[model samples]
Target: MPHSNSPMTEVLVAADCWRNEPDAEAVIQRAITAAAGNVDADVAGADLAIMLTDDAGIRTLNGNWRGIDKPTNVLSFPALQPTGARSDDDAPHMLGDIAIAYETMRREADDEGKPFDHHLSHLAVHGFLHLIGYDHESDADAGAMEALEQEILAQLGIPDPYGNREGMD
Candidate 1:
């Protein structure tokens, strides 16, 4: 648990559709808060940015940063570490940025037969975990990360995202 004096994590959301889908920002923020709470480390005072964009936007970013020409549902860019030691009075740590592709997310939800909001929340949690240094490149690492995601999603009243999948088993 974070110290009582620690500030709450600040979530800055940027999305053109947020006004139309009023609950989108709230869902993203809730996922971030829940995941941070469940993690072992204290990221209570961290700041993160979430950008909601279209598939084309994300595809371009993926190409530019990762050399992949496809659009992903979500992408996380962790903040670069600062060199040397500094005083503890600096501003809250900027955890990094997360971007979600609206079309990709919606398509995935439809394909998976899951609610759109739930799927969005899952992606938000996934992206935040990535920002906090979680990866799924190996079997052990993926299992551990999936367990954490299941726990956090359960707390948010969502069912296990990996259960009953065709190829996941």
Candidate 2:
């Protein structure tokens, strides 16, 4: 088991339509740990929905929530307001929702010539950061976020997911 400064995070995963993947819960737990390490916030709980459907399902969700019809690798619906404000005052704080497209992630990993575990870890960490109000809309912002991702991935024993040709086999 990974050592966590805080107690176990209630990371609820709903594989509504994914397939051909083993140990979804374990993968999710690793992601949560990565997230917790990067941020100083407490991850009391999270509600993540993993859909293994085609682009159409993701498109619908993207359009309805994000107002964009394109299918993305992962979409995070953070249960937090900007400035890291909490919406609830009496509860342990639901971290928010993350939706991942199984096909898209798998394809991206193969095309990028990276291992599935590495890519999945990257995406999960990315989504968790979003839940904690981390965004990369600029080069400087991207650099900071990417560096943080690299650090967390390192802690999890995953190589640089962005590509480390020198270390790859």
Candidate 3:
């Protein structure tokens, strides 16, 4: 049974490419649970969405939202909330939405010699952290965010994703 405070995760398959990994939804859910549980704030009972999209889908989003015009591994779109509680008490708090590109993730995993699930978990954790206001805009912030990602993935028995990068250790 899930804890009453556990955040709710909704996984949507926006592309057929995700069918290559039938366990994508479960992997994402596990990663999100681990991440939300370890975060400093109380994100319990919150609701978040994960879109398993393909390169073309992510490219459109990147072009529209980030103006990058290229497909990335994952993108996090956090919901904006006010300073006060919601007027509707019964509604769950909206955390944010995360979209992951299937082809990019697969290629990255293959290149890194990591299992597909492990890479998926890492991406999900990274996106969840972004939704919670953790960013890598500066060196200090990147270090902090990456450290937290390492810790969370470690809990899932995933080897350090950043270990291969020089000076990231």
lDDT tens digits by residue: candidate 1, 1-169: 3333232444444546545567887788777778877887657666778888878889998999999999999999998866767568976677888889888898899998999889989999999889888999999999999999999999999999888678886
Clashes of each: 0, 0, 0
| Full ranking by lDDT | 3, 1, 2
lDDT of 2 by residue, 1-169 (tens): 5545322544443444455567655776777666686677765454444333456777788999989978888888776533665566654545667777777888898988888877887887888787677889997887788888889999888888766556644
Which candidate wins on lDDT? 3
How does candidate 1 score on lDDT? 0.82
* Candidate 2 whole-model C-alpha lDDT, 0 to 1: 0.70
Candidate 1: stretches off by over 4 Å: 1-19, 83-86
Clashing pairs in 1: none
Q: For residue 98, give model 3's deviation from the true position in Å.
A: 0.3
Relative to the true structure, how large is the alpha-carbon lDDT of every model? Answer: 0.82, 0.70, 0.90
Each candidate structure's TM-score, on Cα atoms with residue i matched to residue i, is 0.88, 0.78, 0.94
For each of the candidates, the C-alpha root-mean-square deviation to the true structure, in angstroms, is: 2.7, 4.4, 1.5
Return whichever of 1 and 2 wins on lDDT. Answer: 1
Off by over 4 Å in 2: 2-17, 44-54, 81-89, 164-169
Ranking by TM-score: 3, 1, 2
